[model samples]
Target: MTAITLIQGDITQQSVDAIVNAANSSLLGGGGVDGAIHRRGGPAILAECRDLRASRYGRGLPTGQAVATTAGNLDARWVIHTVGPRFTREENRSELLASCYRESLRIADELGARTVAFPAVSAGIYGWPMEDAARIAVETVRESVRETESAIEEVRFVLFDEQAYEAFARHVR
Candidate 1:
């Protein structure tokens, strides 16, 4: 069985096989987790992202889609980048949000990663309500494990603060 764990700390510091970044469409680097990963992971990650942009992801990574790059200085061996959709009342984007986790895990399985770390996708500046984000994240990951033949054994949600931790904790149970 896949174990789902929640930790209130930095995703970059976790010694997992891969860390999921709630990245923007550019995948070049932006604020929040994107900026933090780029800053701490050093230039190699960015360089790979640049190469991705120039070749495969020229128009930018689509929302709900995921891709991987070198982890650079981060403890993890790989960084799985996924862009979450912006929240809107007119559109039902829960599936898109779910795809972030599913796609990341798919990539992780391909990389032979047994452990993965993630943030609450789109719950930050993307304006997704914390509770809803947590619900979607937890439910999707759990469902993915049940539905797929993945190599991942441990899935960790690394919340940056106590409030985020508590939000994810409520849904985890």
Candidate 2:
């Protein structure tokens, strides 16, 4: 079984096999976790993202989908970029939000990553409620780990604040 761990720290600093970036569709880089990763992971990360944009993701990565690139200066081997859905009360997009976790894990498995560090997808600038985001992230990861014979052994949620950490901590317990 995969262990769910919570850390109230910067996601960029985690030394895991893979680090999940809560990236925007552009993939080039943006504010919040995406910009932080791009800045810390260095130019090599951006170079791969540019390649992905040039070849496969010409327009941009679709929401709920994920892709990977080199970690560059970070302490991981790969940076798995996943675009999260923007939350809205008019429509239900929880599945897409959950897909961020599921797809990221799937990519992590594909990369033979045993340990992956993730930020709270969509909960930052995308307006996903911290509580709901935490619930979906935890539940989806738990289900994915249970259902698949995956290589991931530890899935760490690296929150940037106390509230986010507490939110995830509630579900992880």
Scored by TM-score, the top model is 2
- What tens-digit string does per-residue lDDT give for candidate 2 at 30-126? 9999999999999999999999999999999999999999999999999999999999999999999989899999999998999999999999889
Provide the lowest-lDDT 10-residue window in model 1.
143-152
Scored against the true structure, residue 141 in model 1 reaches a CA lDDT of 95
Clashing pairs in 2: none
Question: How far does residue 148 in candidate 2 sit from its true spot (Å)?
Answer: 1.0
**Pairs of residues clashing in candidate 1:** none
TM-score of 2: 0.99
- TM-score (C-alpha, index-matched) for candidate 1: 0.98
Off by over 4 Å in 1: none
**Number of backbone collisions per candidate:** 0, 0
Candidate 1: lDDT of 129? 88
